[model samples]
Target: MLLRTLSCLCLLSGVCLAAQAQEEKKAAIKEVTVFLKGAELRSESKVKLPEGESEIVFTNVAGNINEKSLNVGADNGAVVQSATFRNNYLKDNGPTPRAKQIEDSIIYLSDKRNLLQNEITAIDEQINVIRNNRKVSTEEKGISTEELKKLLSLVRTDMKNLLDEKTKTNDSIMKLNTRINLLANQLREENNRDDDPAGQITVKFYCKKATTSNIVIKYVVPTAGWIPSYDLRVPHINAPVQLAYKAHVYQNSGVDWNKVKLTLSAGNPSEGAQAPKLNPWHLGFYRHTPVSYSQPVYNQQTSDYTNTAQAGAIIGNVLDNNGEPIINSVVQAIQGGIVKNGTVSDFDGNYILKPLSPGRYDLKTSYVGYKENITTGVIVNSDKHTAVNIRLQPTDHRLEEVVVRDYKVPLIDKYSTGTGRTITSDEIDAMPTRNTRSVASTAPGVYDGLNIGGARGDGTMYIVDGIQVYGARGINPSQGSNAYDNTMGNYVATENRGVNTTFDIELPYTIPGDGKQINVAVKSAELLASYRYYAVPKMDKDAFLQAQITGWEELDLLPAQTNIFYEGTYVGQGYIDVRNVKDTMNLSLGRDKKIVVTRDRDFTMRSVKTIGSNMKESFVYKINVRNTRSEDIELVLTDQIPVSYYKSINVDDVEYQEAEYNKDSGELLWTLNVEPYKTSTRTFGFTVKYPKRSNINL
Candidate 1:
């Protein structure tokens, strides 16, 4: 009986000791590693444990933490028994500094409102007393006119002051209300859940003896990620391009990352790791086979980005002539003539090819206007970061022909979630649609200019050459608490689009503008064109120089006026109409003074005018064209005859030589091949008969 009683007493004592030895500690966030879609947080706390088991209650943990990723580590030989996570709904955690400032302002305004209310009440009481006193005095004695007027004036003054005070107080109250509302909105926008009350993590630990132990807790949260940005710079057209690899890491994961070491990864963790399989290989005639798939056939991703763990990384810029970065430049690392890895340059003209095997490699760089550059004997060591900056020379040969046909090529996107189209450097340089919104409208599914895929217009995120065109306040990894401005560089002009990502490039070209069309040059090519001089001597006595460039269907160009730069000079502006053009494109390069054309009256072969009940007039004209340039030239001379509106006005004796006559339009054309320093002439005569005294302005 004594032993049983002693054991019960000891058990009670042990329970009492455990209740007393329980420790409550809060962990301070020590480090955070933010990924592309989420962020991992590490926090530490120190606690003194009893010789037996003790419960450590950790406060201030994120409420939306992934419990599966929650882990606890112990130092100083303290063994962790178990850990539990729960929201600390009952804890009276103090408000954040910003929130507290807002609360304090609210309190102050509430006090002011009370003070105003009290003043209004006092004024009402004073007003009532004044009325009563004035009535009593008037009833006491009938005053004279001057005394009554004075009394009335005194009463008016007191009432007016009271009313004015009330009006001022009401105005102040309204202003305070407005300010409070604004403050509330500001607080909400800047909240980021840093104002959460509390969260608790109760960890049970055991130890052989009493000792102080440090516990570290870690978990991942989903509200944080990063973006890869690039800056590619080419020293010159022939020089190698230098690409700068950078990351813009942003996090709102309910914690601040201060002075923590950051390690970025190129792999997407949330993407499911599953291989795709074909249903069956059955090519039959119009058979509606019940082909069912867990994942859609079109939804399968071809590239497996699982190489981030095996190889090292290579990052750098691709620049062009004049030391500008080239946007959308292709950078590939090849080994044994096979492309092992490749990446496109971002806004900053930067490219990062990660998980590259350590060995001697050949890097190939290519851009729309630049010549392909391949550097052999480039070495990449294992577990090391190599900067393989590449530069490519400019090519004068332009791709002038693009066939209009159906291509089964599919676009692959890794970061985007919606559909978008890519605008190549050649395309950007080809058209003169200077409006960014207009340029973006060229993509399919974009509506009303910048409204992409039917989303809100403001939701359209425009990223240029890795920089967000619309600025935002994001957490700068290098500066945690400062603002990082997102400004599109002057050279950022070319583009690529994807489901979730839209690229705006920092191009090597520029077009200066002020409220006018920014006729920027995205790229230029010397297309093979047949030049000719076309003259209408009978109409304007001027000849237009035209260049017909075939195979233009390949250049994705819009119909716009192009600034013609011919023979190393800005000749003038010309129109390019591709709307109805099929196989050939015609460009008018303004007028040519070297191919002079003239129209004159032929007095030597005189025409006579006869008058009677009927009138007849005959006129003779001559056209002369000279090719003064040092090269042979081809030309077409056009002249027109008047079409009479009245039946009485009859035309006859039309003389045309070696020219095609169009009776419907009354136009005559002559195709002429003239040699250098040679002149050609053509003469024609036409007679018109009409009623007497009829004026025909011809």
Candidate 2:
């Protein structure tokens, strides 16, 4: 009986032990606690248990425990199953029933509940203490009932204030939670909006990646405006991708967000049709409307510039191949297009153009007789003057014939006048001439011998380039006569002398390799006037004859016949020997005359001691001449004055005179015979006297 009883006791004890073991197994749960720092203030509360190993999400934990700053660990004796940080959240102790939920709930409400309870308790204690002090009022510190009531009322007011604050705080938390839930819902709704299910989309704005990944987006704000946005929609997932997008801002439309276009493709940068998109995506805002660029207007008044500014400029001269001035050349400023201005050269073949805006320009010159020339890409600047000297080829215009019109006579022929003629280069080449002066002689009435208004002559004034040659002769003989002769008696007449007073000394040779045109102006009447002034002789024959016929018998025997012999007879028989004769003579001798004797005498003639007693009268001759030609030419003037009639023949004020004949051309050219019709005048001075007959040895 005893053995049976013991077996039963052992069996019962084993069953009890097994039952305790099973209860212990049921009590062992995976306990996890997540501590959230810097979280919303709230008290701990029960949370619903999650099935299986569930993850807990915490958002916007305040304080310093941010997503990057968060750290997770197990309690000292507790096991840490798992922990993770994701989506800017700190999650710890996962895969635990009620652990994550309970901690999250505590984190949510701990501060709020603690603050509310602490305020309540503090207010209650203050009210109680004031009541106790009123109950034990002393002489020194007695608390009045009314004062006590007021203090209690203040406590109640404090409680109300605290409650109100708590309510407001709770309201804010609820609103924030609602907002977060709305955002989460919206995300969920748009999750499938992407066309490429396998592709993960990302939007980088101003270098920062978007908060959400694998999303379709629009209306992204740029640095300036809002624009449509896009992302890669492809088969590849979680791949680093780049997309280029264009945004436009219209002048009239403000900003067009819908106009954005994005491109996506990949290849070698050099071989690609377009450049690959780069990181830190650049958002370019292009103009929808055409952008009109305006140049700045510089105001001289204020010394300020507007939106646009004026460019600097250059100024300089343009020349030809011969270093001569190029006239009427087109100078242009070229940037994208051309702006042109024309300038012509002055008399010296010099030109100046100024104040050109700074830019690249082409200098093109065109003249009638020269080939057109063009110089490309002439950089002009304000700092320096651009000097462009262009050498132009000879044009066909030089070969063309130049027609010479007949010379028109001036209205007043008697007055001194100047003649102008235009002779082109072609005409100069065609005309025959010994020198350039001969070319001028082709004109009618031009004298070749004197080179006065004649072919190959030098009577005309010669001006070459801008310099006047020395010894330039005008048509008037007095104006151009040699400086030696001052008296009118020695003046030479230039009338009937074809004088080419105008010639170009600049280009003496007309056919000197396509020479330029020459302009000439001749003054014939002026030459004549000059000749009459300085070339004609002034003599007093009457006084000379009176001095010579001193004897009265010789005078009586001289005449009784005619008035011409009266003076001679008066001085011949009874009168003392004549001393001098004087008279004014205006003689019009023929073209070819040697000795010009005057018939009229005002007084008697006489013989001076210098001559013999038989000599009675004395006379002097004077002459002058001029040269007119393009070039210097030989000139000669010959006069025969009887030595018997003149005591002395003085060749005074003679320029370039020859003693004998000229070997060249077998012509007496003591006066220059120029290339053309040139005028030349010569003057000679002579003193004639008669010896007395008594002293004469026959």
Top lDDT prediction, candidate number: 1
- Superposition TM-score, candidate 2 onto the true structure: 0.19
What are the RMSDs of all candidates, in order? 22.2, 49.8
Model 2: worst 10 consecutive residues (lDDT sum):
559-568
User: Each model's C-alpha lDDT?
Assistant: 0.54, 0.28
* TM-scores for the candidates: 0.39, 0.19
Least accurate stretch of 10 residues (summed lDDT) in model 1? 451-460
Cand. 1 Cα-lDDT? 0.54
Tens-place lDDT digits, model 2, residues 1-698: 99999999999999877634421101111111111101111111112222333222222121111222233332222222433322222222222222233334444455555565666566567657755754564333576779767866766676576667666656666654554444344333222111111111111112122121111111111011111111111111111111111111111001111212211111111122355776896789976995432556542211234342234443555555545444323343333332233334432335544435567877655443344577788787643467766565543321111121123332112232222222322222122221112221121211221111101111233332222221132234332111112232122121211321111112111110001112122111110100111111222111011111112221111100000001001000011111211121111101111112222222233223444344333332323333222334332233333323234322222222342433332222233343433433343222333334433221
Candidate 2: segments with Cα more than 4 A from true spot: 1-310, 327-330, 334-337, 397-698
The residue-by-residue lDDT of candidate 1 on 374-464, one tens digit each, is: 8888888765678877765554432221111112332111222112232222222222211122221122111121211110000112332
- Clash counts per candidate, in order, are 34, 146
